[model samples]
Target: MKKNDIIITYGTHISKMVRMVLDKAELALSIPKNARIGIKPNLVVAKTHDSGATTSPLMVEALIQYLQEHGFYDIIILEGSWIGDDTKRAFSISGIEKVAEKYKVPLLDTKDDTYCKIQAGPIEMEISKTALDLDFIITMPVLKGHCQTKITGALKNFKGCLSDKEKRHFHTLGLHRPIAYLNTVLHPGFILMDGLCGDLDFEEGGNPVPMNRIVAGLDPVLIDSYVASAMGYEPDEIDYIKMAAELGVGSMDLEHANLMVLEKDTCPVKTIRSRKVQALAKAVTEKNACSACYANLIQALARLEERGLLSYYKKHPVCIGQTFRDQSGNSLGIGSCTCRFIHSVPGCPPATADILKGLLTGLNTK
Candidate 1:
């Protein structure tokens, strides 16, 4: 596919849909037959693809099958689950291991791989060696909402290729700047987004909203900018996308993007702003907050909202972010940065479920 082209198709048959997009995008023709191809999917958690938190094994298998049929055999699937999660377990739980076995393709857990430092723009970070060794990389990211960045698509998916230390460090650097810089150093040859069903409010995925589509493109910035618009946010609202555009990663101009819809499904789904998310966000007092920490708070608040326990937050607004560090307060706070507060959920970015339980127990005591 050309860098400016974005091919899309819709269906419930996951394998057929993926093949359709790949064929239409001319993805096979764009790569060398002898190239070492790495298929990178978002396995941020140990969850089934239906959970909408990870890429579908059916999609990956289809791509692999298509590649082999096209005379490209040097293929491998690699990924690193988000910090505190196990990639090997994710591969099993997500059914990717079965796909790897079926294709006789080895699965590389980047978490266990060595890394090399790379400089991009004014920033330097370590990336997994396996990722750098690949001649071509196909990134398959789930198009989903993120509490901090607002959305995660093609651009943010590259975070999986970094070392665990670098992944954690990306958050402390505010996520956007480092994500943008990383793209300069590592560019995916192609991007295939899982738009079938994705959680609309959180990245780890529980509340899946089905859209029943697959999107393929060559430009991360262009695809992500379109994703931002589709998810009800301006491209500029997603800091990394805008930054990547400025750093000359790719174009963000959707007006010029060649959008091709091979098969538009009937009753197409469109993203709408969640009233619950709006109400929950009002309860947070954030300043320069990290994505993980903020996302955890949002997930916790969402649980509280569902349980009809969010009323407690009305009186005690939740505080989060770097600005809250070393600051003492009587209010409830959400991360280690806000530890000085009277009530704080500790951890650099505490687990969402833990945050939920902590808020329920701690707020009840207040």
Candidate 2:
């Protein structure tokens, strides 16, 4: 299969799907037996894959089994959870540690590992040593929407390899160009997107939209572009994906890329779930809001509407993001970005439950 070739195998049997893709790609012949392979999965939170916040451990187990069957034993699973979350806890909660133990594959927490400075253009970031040492890298990212970047797929999953300090610094710098630069420098041998159940609008995952399928590809940018189209977005809609394409990481031109299906997909690609997110975001007075903060607010409102407590939300816009700084009025704000507002939900990215309660309290006080 060409680098631009994307293969989609639809089924609940994840291991079978994984093996099928590898066989079709002829991955074993391409790499040496003694090569040090690193399997990177998105484990941003201490949550199960069913929650859509992390990669499926079943998928990892299948990949490990596939490698071991092909005389490849030098495999290690590495990841760092998002700031404020524990990587070890994420591994345990996501059942990745158990998978690692079963396969006798060591697990490395990038959070504790020393980092080396990597610079691409003006973007300088610290990446974990294990990430840099691997002979081959396989990324398993949960396909989902990101509040800041619009989408998180192959390229964005590498953010987990950064040190906690660098992760925060990436936010301080614009996320788009840095993400592009990161992918430009660090290359992944293959990408396996966990699309069985993923959050429609949140990278951290709360409302999972089930679409049982495994998407395997060699090109990260092409995979991300296809995911963009599948999720009701143009490739250009996401700045980072476009930027990555521009930086020569890979092609986003899906029209030219060969998308093959190993079998007929019983589950057709759909975008109806994201429309609800668009509708919910309409009530948000947002400007430069971070992904986690915006996602929290949306999920909180969703919970309220579901529980019939949405009536408690006053008929006014709920403001959020850095653009709301020093802004005043009766507007209910969220996160530290809206600290200037008297009526605000606290935290850099406040908990979804806390956001719901804060909004309810604000309404009652009014």
Candidate 3:
């Protein structure tokens, strides 16, 4: 909306989408015709675009061509995939090298960048040193579902800028929400979201859904809001969106902004979950169970509290195992009936009975 909120475009032709997005924005980015530009993309997993997993290289190269035409050169195609998959290998396998060769741009595997630690929000993170010296960083991220945060957009793409070792810690800090908090401080200069193909659930893990759409914007929150809309969910479903909004990141409610729906596009996409569900949300192994269960438990507790049935746990902090060190009262564990990880009604997570008991255990229901 307005001159800057978010630009939505449709098409597989990379150049056409870039031009359409910028045209819709109605503003020109005044970079030199021969300035140094870096094309940073979501090369996570190094999978092809059809997999709905990674950023499409065609889109990244498209930005390069657009920059070149507008008087830019000395460009570098940068990405840091993961541990086992080399960025160089992913670049070659995904045909990023071909695009780089065609454009004579350097292919940079950012894992080699000198590291710098920066503290923000509740966590301290390590980032690439190249960030300080870059003339401009053009971000291209695949719009997809994430098990932890719901959807990954411009902000999540910042994970690519960190070394693989640091990424492990990102998971440690509570996955999705922590990552969003981390990105708010490390702002990228420009962001062009690649939605040509995206996983409807779990950004990097879920099966790809064919949603041929792209959203571009300078505001990471705006881009995230668009991706949330595309996934058929509300912005509040994502914790970071709420946190970012509270942190004065940007508006999640884009309907109030300068939203210009293309005449060629549908009014809005149907909720993806309404269709055949492709994947189930599961917690990553790295997170302690407490941080993972805190939100849900809090919600359940609130409901119980409203019903005047939440007093048992006052004697002790309900410890859900590793999430915290020890509990002061009667601690109960829960496990899903269907999971092999479950031994019985009470296992590890926080069982329904335990919850009900907790709700009524200390309350004067009489």
TM-score of 2: 0.74
**lDDT: the better of candidates 1 and 2:** 1
Candidate 1: which stretches are off by over 4 Å? Answer: 267-366
Pairs with backbone N, CA or C atoms under 3 Å apart (clashes), candidate 1: none
> Model 1, 1-366: lDDT tens per residue?
678998977667789989889888888888976999999999999999767689989999999999999998999999999997899999999999999999999999998899998987777889999999999999999988887898899999989998999998999999999999999988899999998777766789876656567899999999998777656456887899999999999999988989888874533223324565567777888777754355446656765775688887876678877889999988877778888887888875554555776778776788
- Candidate 3, residue 273: how far the Cα is off, in Å: 17
lDDT at 281, model 3: 14
Compute the lDDT for candidate 3.
0.61
Tens digit per residue, CA lDDT, model 2, 183-282: 9778898888887777876888876655566788889999999777655466898998998998889998988988777853333223324566666666
Task: Flag regions of model 2 displaced more than 4 Å.
Answer: 267-366
Q: How would you encode candidate 3's per-residue C-alpha lDDT over 258-321 as one tens digit per residue?
A: 6544423222222223222211111111124432132223333433544554445444334343
- State each model's CA lDDT, in order: 0.82, 0.80, 0.61
Q: Which of candidates 1 and 3 reaches a greater TM-score? A: 1
Native-to-model Cα distance after best TM-score fit, residue 210 in candidate 1, in Å: 0.7
